[model samples]
Target: MASFQKDFKIWVMDHLPGSALLSEPLSLEPIAGDAGFRSYFRLNTQIPLLAVYSPPQEENNLAFVRVSHHFSSGKIKVPKIFAVNFEKGFMLLQDFGTELLQPLLNLDTLPQYYDLAEELLLDLQLLHPGDSIFPNYGKPQLIAELQLFQKWFVDKLLMLDLSQRDLSILDDLFELLIGNAMEQPIVIVHRDYHSRNLIVHNNQIGVIDYQDAVVGPITYDLVSLLKDCYLSWPEEIVRQRALSYKSRAVSKGLMREIKDQKFMKWFDWMGLQRHIKVMGIFARLSIRDNKESYLSELPRVVNYVLSTTFNYSELKPFNQWFSERICVCLPRYPWYSGD
Candidate 1:
């Protein structure tokens, strides 16, 4: 047996001795991975399970386990961790299946699935973080994320040399975005709540890749869900869905009665903060990790930036910078066409 495979088997036997998996032969097949460093495989044994091999150096397996436990305790629909070997960075989990919510999404199915998603989100929001440790997504962290767009996307990927004026405008824009985010109601944030990280199983929505959950602006996850990085919905539909969620949230006392305009502003600005960070992250993933497919999603994210920024007079300067400096150069790259 290969040393790595042998090590995985040994760890499983030691950690999961009484499980039914040991009663039969084990077979594993590779499954598609996420943006993170962890790799997954299906354990085709008498009892179906998933074998996750997270590189100890790159992934925080312990935090994943702890968060899984916390979510499970709160009745959140997250995959169950059957066993884990933190030292080896190996874990056995309940197989949620191959049905990511992204592929099933369309105009027809959008409302149904999104309604369920919002319900799940509200459950997470209402749950008290009594003993669970979640990182604070505060001003410093928010500002740092905004910087990713300038550092990785602009400087590294686009190779743009910004003049002093451009740099000053970007800094001002970052602070504006940070202020918008910090002004919202804070709650549990599932940092990546988009369709791809959601699993549609047995007529229920199961969430994954939640290790980066945080206490942040309540609108953060809502924006991540409705104005997704991987898909787009009509502006009217997005606004309606967001309003519906706000009504429910207010009824449940999860959110105070804020003006619809204020809520939408929060959602839009929060999306810009997220999309800006994503541009930097996607570029870094392609350049540093050789995950080139992430580059293809850049144009959609850029469009989100422009569409949101164009509406606000305060963001006109940044919008002009994008139109003058970035959008014109986009056609040169195969991944972006300024659509």
Candidate 2:
């Protein structure tokens, strides 16, 4: 075993003395990790738990602990933290099991599960930002996320050539997306609220991978869930679900009453911002992080981008450039399909 894994096993032992993990050390099995650098191991004790090794340099372990407490206080279903050592970046947390919400979703079970998720989302948005270590999802951060597309996806992954005019057009598009996001009701955003990050635990949606929560757009997490990068759903159906959330939000006073068209524009444009940032993040995960599996999902995200690009008149120029340039280049990449 690698030195780091061995060290983590030792750390787990140090924290929990009488647990079966000490007697049966081999019961600790490596589980899959997310896009980040954290590593998780399942402890098959009398009560299952997860031993997590999250690097303090790369991850906000402090925020994770703080937000976990905050969300739990707000009656959200999150893993219970058994033990933590911030200096070493190790923790023993309640294992929510391997049942991800993504695989369980189907046409028959869709409405029920989605309704549960939406209601849970309202609970999340109701959390006060000042109650925790939440930060502003402001102009600098939004722009930086947008530039991820330019640096990783366009340049490193695709290596696209563009004229000054094309760059100008992209700037305007970015401005509009960021502007729309800034106009929304500010609340605690889970930053990565999507299907794969959610688990079905004991008949409730158990949310995870929320270390990056921030005070930002109300529609941000909603868009991330309904229009997930990992799953494909009909656009019209996704929009209708978003409207359902909109009604709940207004009723809860999470948002003011707005016209359907106006709300949709916010929803769709918010998705564009997220999808654009995700393209860069996925490209970085492939090239820099050696996780090529993220490349395979590009087609679905590309489909999302194309759908939004075509819907808005202001996005016509970028849409044409994407079709003529970006689309033409995508077919060459083995992971990309025509979608």
Measured by TM-score, how close is model 1 to the native structure? 0.96
lDDT of 2 by residue, 281-303 (tens): 99999999999999999999999
Q: Give the 10-residue window scoring lowest on summed lDDT in candidate 1.
A: 15-24
The residue pairs in collision within model 1 are none
- Give TM-scores for every candidate, taking all chains together and pairing residue i with residue i: 0.96, 0.96
Worst 10 residues of 2 by lDDT: 17-26
* Model 1 agreement with the true structure over 1-339: per-residue lDDT tens digits: 499988887676565535545555666688899999988888766655788899889998877888888889999999988888778789988888999989999999998899889999999999786565788899999888888888889999999999999999889989899999888888888899999999888898999999888899989999999989899999999999999899999998888999999899999999999998999999999989999899999888999999999998889999999899988988999888534
